[model samples]
Target: MDHFLGIFVVANCYRNGIGVVRSLQNANYWYQKERDKQLVATRELPYNVDNGLKNMLLENKYRLSWIPYNEFKNIEKIGEGGFATVYYAVWDNKYLDADIPAALKIIHRSKKYSEKDYSEQFIKELKAYCDIGYDNPSFLECYGVTMDDVSKEYIIVMRHALEGCLRKNLSSVAMMGWQNKLTLLLCIISDLKTIHSKKYYSSRFT
Candidate 1:
């Protein structure tokens, strides 16, 4: 766990200070103003990451590798989040004759998000990752997309972080010196500043 994730998980909170996000409204707006706005802002939390990325790949003419589930070997559950489950797997690259370790994020369908809603959300998130990918080394590097055969759910394949999330290693950070903590916070602030400028916001940042 590192301070960088402090922003990684909630970088979108920067949307408020930036004019980048295009706000969408629904009929529910009449009953609840503030709450409805928040709902509209985050109506789709990307538990379903594939459908959106698929469309994006087509629209943008971008090609993201599609690896079948069977190619992932020794899959083991590592962690679970509100919207997705994380797994540790080794990607067997047939052409390269190499095994690549990766983290697979499998999004779970929720009662709150239908296919349309979640698909849009997943696309938004994938776009955000693209924005931060190579240009910003601090973010997770997404390799490709895959699916869980049994669940028919999509998975995001990315570089595995052996250290896990910062929350998992908070104790170590708490023991660090003031200068170090400040430096970490500075990194998070810098990342957040970038997210904000991109006109994206993650309501999960609180």
Candidate 2:
């Protein structure tokens, strides 16, 4: 199996034009030697694969369908604040084939709060996100929520930002030219205006 894998890797590298021609030549030479050894062993041994190997292959297949959190496979941790940790994850949209990315915010269920309070806060956050809407592309969009099976922790998922957070971008303001600073200011103002409008509308309705 290792020999077969080596040959596959070499073939893939060759096809993809990975590295220079000389590197590919060396890989192909080594791969050919391994393949010859495998061919010689084929007649001597009975093909009996262990259950562990089979299980590993199955796990890999499952992982290819969806990204795992612990492995940090497709998700990248980009930001964190008092309330939540943010990750830039590939949004599957519940489809195995979908490769679109999105931002996922994980809000920890505070041990200090009661279950009722936690639920209420979750709802409020959802409402706030909805009220804000997707007016500005810079504004994060809430995609969905999920719960951890064992821990029973709730997580809020949102759209991933390719450019990252405002706080981080502001760190090197001196390096930024006037036009860039103006653009950043505009985005901040737009976000604040949306929040203010929502606050006023909600207050009047209440």
Best candidate, TM-score: 1
Which tens-of-lDDT digit does each residue in 1-206 have in candidate 1?
23323333333223111233311112112112221121111122234445556565544332345667888999999888788888999888564455767799887767788777766666665667656643443445666667688887777777676556667667878998885676556655766776777776765542
Error of 2 at 19 (Å): 36
Q: Summing lDDT over every window of 10 consecutive residues in candidate 1, give the lowest-scoring window.
A: 34-43
Error of 2 at 66 (Å): 16
| lDDT for predicted candidate 1 compared with the true structure | 0.58
Q: After superposition, how far is residue 160 of candidate 1 from its true place, in Å?
A: 1.4
Displacement of the residue 134 alpha carbon in candidate 1, Å: 5.1
lDDT of 2 by residue, 76-158 (tens): 78877777777777654332233445666666678899766766666566556644643332244454454444555555655
